[model samples]
Target: MSDELPDSIHLVLVERLPNHIAVVTLNRPEVRNAINPAITSELGHVVQALNADDVWVIVLTGAGDKAFCAGADLTTVGSGQLDDLWTDDAGFAGFVFAKRTKPWIAAVNGAALAGGLEMALACDMIVADERSTFGLPEVRVGLVAIAGGAFRLPRVIPPAIAFEMIATGQSIGAQRAFSLGLVNSVAPAGDSVTIALELATRIAGNAPIPVRESLAIARRTSDLTESELVRMSDEAWSRLSKTEDFAEGPRAFLEKRSPIWLGR
Candidate 1:
């Protein structure tokens, strides 16, 4: 639970948990935790490790209280490192541009603008600190929100509001982001990562099979046609029916006991 990080890696930190929750920290406080090519590579490794069945949920955060990520590292970007910014696994600037089956939660500590906001959008949930601010400021810098923000923002919030935020490059407060359904929860500054970790732990306590399948269903359902949705629902129901947790739920329900989910 300490805020201290290792002396190396320059960008990311990974801490394992008891119930399969992994906390991935963006470690670059001196530069407000900017996302550079090195950081993206480190993040790719951390994310790959979290994709294992032994790790259910991953909470993404920053090293210090100043910022989750101030955005792309302009210094690095200008130095010609932007071309190879993403990881080799088609992960955009880390995991922002890739879709992994496992669930991820963004724990925004402070400013999360441009590519940083895009990173949060890639996650399944967002837990932001009260001092945190979000913006897609690419337009202001003569670029565009190419990293999922252009596609995901409108889907998450009202299109007009999403448009305003993206086009205007205006920052939204953490509470305001929550009101607009952009963030799951807003906590006091410095507590965002802790809250995300607790939530991740709760989710990790569930059966692994169902947790992943359920997340898949929810994420895919948003883009599914009526026919496809029905098919997916049936498939999920059938798959869960074969799981040991499926029977345990009902048995424990009748016996008034806490079901022990083996994550089969």
Candidate 2:
């Protein structure tokens, strides 16, 4: 897999893990893995490639323990080149607002500020280091977190707390983020990526068809009425029931053996 990837992919590292999980590392640790046009473009390409691959789960993290991502490269904030960072299909960083059925987890190794926090918020789940911090400090610089931070934050945590964090431009500790349900779990220092991979492995062990269908329906109908959600779920189940894994699960349970999933 490494050899298949381009030699020019210096901004990000893509590793194919066991159990069909892909780990994508933001490699610019010298600047706290800050997002530049190069990073964004490389990351976008990686995500797009993985989405089409056979991988079931993706875990994203930074290269070093000092930071997950400090947000956009402020040095390029006003540079005309930064405009290239945005993709009509993937939004910022290529993951946010991207139409994806597979799950993604953010392994926050350190502080995730502004666009960084938004990137984490874009994932289905987040696992942060115990010493890590999260915040939307864009307000301090006369900017707002337009990369899904303002909207996703309020939905994940309480609206008031999300508002406070966005408005005050202050950061919150990992423990606080866990309490608010913003982070799925908190790992020991330097173990965030490990824990996130464990979580991804668990998800990958499930029936891929149902897992993807469930994720698609949940994300699509989170704002819909109960009846609408039920209708969607019913429709999804109708299709899922015809899948090979649906029959394999019952046969495996009856045989008291593990199912061999074909991801059909």
Candidate 3:
């Protein structure tokens, strides 16, 4: 893959792994995978390119085992360059509020706090290691989770627990997160990426168009009402009916053959 930004090759690493999966790894392990300006710009461009490519799944993780992300770089924040950590379209960390049609899985290797947790929450699903932790610790620093953690956490997990974490700036363990329905699965330490890739491969084997459409609607579950969701589902069906893979799915099933999705 071409590096959009010159220094991006050193900050963020983008790899096209097997099974049509593209893994975006935060490469600033020296800083515990903290988000800097270059990381924001590079990740935004990378995500945009992946969306236009033929890839089926995108997995995000950190390079080292110490942390998935430590949130914004304190050095940048202290240098008055905090604005660089955001894009006009993608928002904080080039992801929290970005519009993505494909399925994204966050493979949390370690602690995902503040903006890091917000990024995980932005993904369609999360695969965290048993040693990984999640929380919003901005309040402890006299700041707030402007990256959407304060609000998104309440919706992803229980609001009561969300408030406790948000206010206390304390993190929860992987097992507790799984028990609270915060993460899809918790693997053994250092196995989050492997498990997430397997899950992504399973999703990639199916039709891609419906999967993207389904993700689009499901992301809005908290924003839409029952009637609005019905309308959105109808719209998705209408859109899917025009795609070649939609019809191929049924034809292949009746013919007792595996469906070959054209990914239209």
Which wins on TM-score, candidate 1 or candidate 2?
2
Better of 1 and 2 by lDDT: 2
A best-first ranking of the candidates according to their TM-score comes to 3, 2, 1
Clashing pairs in 2: none
Residue lDDT tens for model 3, 122-208: 999999999999989998888889989989899988899999999999999999999999999999999999999999999999899
TM-scores for all predictions: 0.91, 0.94, 0.95
- Highest TM-score: which candidate? 3
RMSD of each: 3.9, 2.4, 2.2
Which lDDT values do the candidates have, in the order given? 0.82, 0.87, 0.90
Which stretches of model 2 miss by more than 4 angstroms?
1-8
At residue 37, candidate 3 shows an lDDT of: 94
Candidate 1 residue spans exceeding 4 A from truth: 1-10
Candidate 2 accuracy as TM-score: 0.94
Clashing pairs in 1: none
Given candidate 3, what's the lDDT at residue 36? 91
Highest lDDT against the true fold, candidate:
3
